[model samples]
Target: MAGTLTVWKFDSPTGADTAITTLEDLQKQELITVLDAAVVSWPADKKKPKTHQLNNVTGAGALGGTFWGLLFGILFFIPLIGAAVGAAVGALTGAMTDVGIDNDFIAQVKDKVTPGTSALFVLTTDATIDRVHEEFRGQSAELISTNLSHEQESQLREVFAD
Candidate 1:
């Protein structure tokens, strides 16, 4: 069905929270997707900050914890095939924990978020973009959507496209 899609990019967590609350309130009348996302923030005047590690396995103690859990699981059911199953589980868990820039489009945004420039993206369908924008006009967020002019629609399509 034809519906409106509204996107708002917030500057920080506070702005994101406010937008999320507003969108959720509107959800009583429409559908919304407040995707949970995070980016490194840094001061623009200073040099850019490096990407912080997000690997759950490689990080200190995380892999060890995974292995420890597997060991416990295996020991608890020694007579059964728990050892082999637990080993497989632990290996799969560790392999899945690698944090790589899987999506090129999102990676661009990841690279831009410095030590003080986080962004939160909220997408809502069949909602009034103007109402949402008016509610969050003062905050450091820009509302971009196809609800605007043809040019804006095309721009938004490209930005949100695969």
Candidate 2:
């Protein structure tokens, strides 16, 4: 099955990490399959969030470091560069579009995930949506799907091919 890039934002700094336990449980239950997973935890006192790849669940399908680094860097770092480097910003935008992500999605994530907030970034497939949703009914998480375009899919394949 084709993988979907999805993110879920939680109110607390530890929320995303806490959710990982549940995610592992669900995966074992055969309710969902994960390609790769990572957690972003941002404490109130921190300047920025920290990331950790879930290596145990990540098998052959994993996109690993480069994919997540570029994405999180775009979401959390690029803005600091601002228009001073207009060409770089434009190139960054182009790079994002090459992976089938748009400005709207980037803006949305930037808006929702802030200091004291945590997010779970997941590349997943074969999920029983209803069951998964039911399991997560307790926490308030904003779900965002990248919904990779055909072009994005092709680019991702090329990225993994190397």
Candidate 3:
């Protein structure tokens, strides 16, 4: 089956952290197959968010470490790379574009996930969308997933720069 990359935004700093448990439980029920996952938790007092890769949960299908690093780097570290990384930033941007993660999506993620907020990025396949969606109901979670098509995700693995 084709895979999907999904991002969920939460109002509270620990909301995404809490949701991880739910996701794991859902996976156990066979409602979804989680390939990999990560969380960005930005506490109220912190200047930036903390990005954590859920290494333990990832199975044989883990997307390499560099993929996650580059993604979070683009999302949170571009400012630091603005002048320093120079042309490399252009290359990274180009690579991300190849995967359908365009500037608009990046800007939207930046706009919504801020300090005192959190986000969960999950790579999965065979998801029961409505059932998974219902699990988070009555919560402040917003599905801010780039919602990349399976084709886009396939392109991502092929084109992502090391």
Candidate 4:
């Protein structure tokens, strides 16, 4: 059997709304289970009463900023190796901010999500990755990253099957 893995990366929580709706529709057509939902939200608010249950999994700004820094450095320096070390160091400094965990930026972000910067990852593995991709052809969401192929998905499904 073959399977597919599609990562629907979104800038906001609602970005996956369409995908979720599509999943619901797909569920109507066939049996499907959500393998995982990655959400970046405020840690304290995530556990509060009356809060949405799914937003518990959170991402942090400082970490994301750091990631952006590192990515920017590598991407920028790729074509300009003459500036690699300088760019990398610059990226690291630009990531720091006042009033957060010092030297533990990632930990701080994990403990307290920064404002206005986060991501949600919806990982769906089904025998029908193509259909899912078709369902998400054009939308406002950005494809931040992805991993998987037909053969790999099949192997993964078997390894993680019910």
Candidate 5:
């Protein structure tokens, strides 16, 4: 099945958290199917960001770790050493590329989502954008990136731009 991966940035961690909850509600209502979701929150006092994934299945957990690890590595420009780390990175990169999410997008998200802020990364199927926008009306959030067509991305930007 085709899926869209999107990153929504918020000025405050609380806004991101609320948006995640809204996404959960949409999933429950069958408006969207959330395959995977993660939140990156950077607290003011913390030196590093905290990432939390929606699903905690063992297999999914390891994949999620690779995803976040690569992200953090890119974000901080950490050089990967050892064959195991290199191999894992290579594998994850290929997997993400196949899914239409490239390293560039991840880097962009890492750059934009800063300390005291948060971002929600969602992989979803059958999303009702209009209804989701309505649910988020009057809320503050930025559509950072998505594996969506130009027109669709524009529509989403306009929806949240207000």
Candidate 6:
């Protein structure tokens, strides 16, 4: 099966960063394939979160750029300094709907991952969920949302929407 878009939330940015590292390690071990990953770290001072997307550095090239560019475009309304890139990203965002990610999911992540917290957005396949869960033992991280199912998504929305 194709990978799913998943968001993992942590109480602290450090925790989220650690989780990303662990995910990378898993990928190295051939336990999972990380298509693309992004981390959002909200400063304690309540400034705009710093976002680091791995797609740019991982050779995802244009497709990766378009995905993250469109995402940040939606989250921050980043002025599409260039009309061509902006148009391409906009169209890509629409095309991504078939993959189970949409503006609503992005909006939810933006709204829920508040100041002083962090979130890791991952597109992955061949994940060993049980092993991953075991790896996260004792962590306060929560699986906030995913392209899993409607009932689960609704439950997550209810829990974090407040």
lDDT for each of the candidates? Answer: 0.38, 0.80, 0.83, 0.40, 0.66, 0.66
Better of 1 and 6 by TM-score: 6
Error of 3 at 100 (Å): 1.6
* Native-referenced Cα lDDT, model 6: 0.66
Off by over 4 Å in 3: 159-162
Q: How close is candidate 5 to the true structure, as a TM-score?
A: 0.70
Compose the digit string of candidate 4's lDDT tens values, residues 1-162.
222223344444445554556656665666444444444432323432111213222122112333333332332233355664776555443432221113343333333323333433443445365665576677544444344455454444343343
TM-score of 2: 0.86
Ranking of all predicted structures according to TM-score, beginning with the best and ending with the worst: 3, 2, 5, 6, 1, 4
lDDT of 6 by residue, 59-115 (tens): 462225446655666664544355757776676566555445666876777777878
Per-residue error (Å), model 2, residue 84: 8.0
Model 4, residue 136: distance off in Å is 1.7
What lDDT does candidate 3 reach at residue 5? 80
Top TM-score model: 3
Put down candidate 5 lDDT per residue, 1-162, tens digits, no spaces: 345677888888667788877887887888877756777887767666777776731125323545555555655434535465777667656655554557787678867888888877776668898997787666688876556554443433333232
Reference-based lDDT, residue 88, model 3? 84
Q: List the residue pairs that clash in candidate 4.
A: 40-59, 41-58
Instruction: Please give the range of 10 consecutive residues that has the lowest summed lDDT in model 1.
Output: 50-59
Worst 10 residues of 4 by lDDT: 49-58
Q: Which wins on lDDT, candidate 3 or candidate 4?
A: 3
Q: Indicate whether candidate 2 or candidate 4 has the larger lDDT.
A: 2
**On a 0 to 100 scale, what is the lDDT of residue 118 in model 5?**
84
Superposed by TM-score, candidate 3 places the C-alpha of residue 33 at a distance from the truth, in angstroms, of 1.4
- C-alpha lDDT (0 to 100) for residue 134 of candidate 1: 70
lDDT of 5: 0.66
